[model samples]
Target: MSKETETMKHNAEVAQFRFALIAPVIQGLFPDASATAYYKRVSAAPLMLPEGTSVKYSYKTLENGNPCTAPEGLIH
Candidate 1:
């Protein structure tokens, strides 16, 4: 397959995984938030994790369920 087709497939997979990961968090935080509302809120607000949050390598692996590097500038 072409590189463009592979990239598209990879992106689609990532989008699906991201949605799945966020769904539970959204529901927990905003019990009444529908999928539409969740998307809207996600578009509007960024996650501002407060200070003193520890970084866990296991959590990163769990999030992607694959071997990947944690995003830079994530901890402030």
Candidate 2:
């Protein structure tokens, strides 16, 4: 694949991984009392990516997922 194609492929994989990580929060699948606690708990933990690397998502990234479930009083 071309360099640009490779980059796009990686980015698409990353986006899918991110959505999988935050799917519950976005879909209200978890039973957290509020979004804040959920974000805090999740942000506190490390996430493993497809490349076998570990990372932690920032509050802003998680908050920006679903427009309906963000800011206001959910995340800072």
Candidate 3:
């Protein structure tokens, strides 16, 4: 649609890429961790890393699920 909207989307995409790049770096410091494990830890860190860093994980979610875990939770 508009230039402003397009710019915003581009910026968001860039931020996601940057986060993904940093994720592995942060995960590498851990001992014998899987990629998914690294992603999980990285996603949680952004939750408290100031506004900009936190924005990178705005839509992040864990893949862990259960048949009886949070039957009424919206995220489940």
Candidate 4:
């Protein structure tokens, strides 16, 4: 495969792995929640971050699938 194709494949694999890691948690939190709705809510929620910081923020998924800023760089 070409380098670009290989890179794309790797990215796709990583995305799938990330989804796998989070899917169970999302399911457990919102047993009846639709994936589309859950993602929409998550995307709309404000990320908790330090003021005046332009850092890349990480989020923790709440019981309702809401995304909250992780504390101390720890995933909730």
Candidate 5:
């Protein structure tokens, strides 16, 4: 791919990854909201993290036998 094309591809991947990260949270928080409204609400909410900390998501099995991704954090 050309340099510009490569950059666009990477940007699209990043956007999709970010959406995946937030999708479950948005759905849980706004179960009855439309997609457009959910996006609006989530975008307007404040996401605060402590200094030297990062968020990470991990997939694990729940007691009910369903797999889920839970967000965790690492603090430096």
Candidate 6:
């Protein structure tokens, strides 16, 4: 693939990964305080990627990237 194509594909994958990581919290089943705690707990652990490597997003990053938290954006 071309460099641009590769970068786009990687970005798409990362977005999907981020969505999956925050899916539970965005479902609106939890109270606001619970959601905050959930993010902290999730950020405290490593996430397993599709390729099997683990990575973790910090609480701020995850919360900032969450679709529901954003003022405007397509949620998934």
Candidate maximizing lDDT: 6
Model 1 Cα displacement at 17 (Å)?
1.1
The weakest ten consecutive residues by lDDT in model 5 span: 58-67
What are the TM-scores, per candidate, against the unseen true structure?
Answer: 0.35, 0.63, 0.34, 0.38, 0.37, 0.61
Candidate closer to the true structure by lDDT (higher is better), 2 or 3 = 2
lDDT of 3 at 2: 100
lDDT of 3 by residue, 1-76 (tens): 8999988887777656554444443445533255455546655654533234554342223322211222332123
Candidate 6 steric clashes? 0
Candidate 4 matches the true fold with a TM-score of 0.38
Model 5, residue 26: distance off in Å is 1.5
Ranking of all predicted structures according to TM-score, beginning with the best and ending with the worst: 2, 6, 4, 5, 1, 3
**C-alpha lDDT (0 to 100) for residue 23 of candidate 6:** 86
**Model 5: colliding residue pairs:** none
Candidate 6 lands at a TM-score of: 0.61
lDDT of 2 by residue, 2-44 (tens): 9999999988887787676567877888677877667677778
Encode model 5's per-residue lDDT on 1-76: one tens digit a residue.
8999988887676555455535554447545355444444444544323332353333211111112333432110
Q: For residues 9-71, write the lDDT of model 1, one tens digit per residue.
A: 877765565545355543465453454454444445333222323333333333333123234
Where model 2 places Cα greater than 4 Å from the true spot, the runs are: 51-53, 70-76
Q: What local distance difference test score does each model get?
A: 0.44, 0.71, 0.45, 0.45, 0.42, 0.73
Candidate RMSDs in Å, in order, are 13.7, 4.4, 8.4, 12.2, 14.3, 4.4
Cα lDDT for residue 35, model 6?
75
lDDT of 3: 0.45
lDDT of 2 at 53: 99
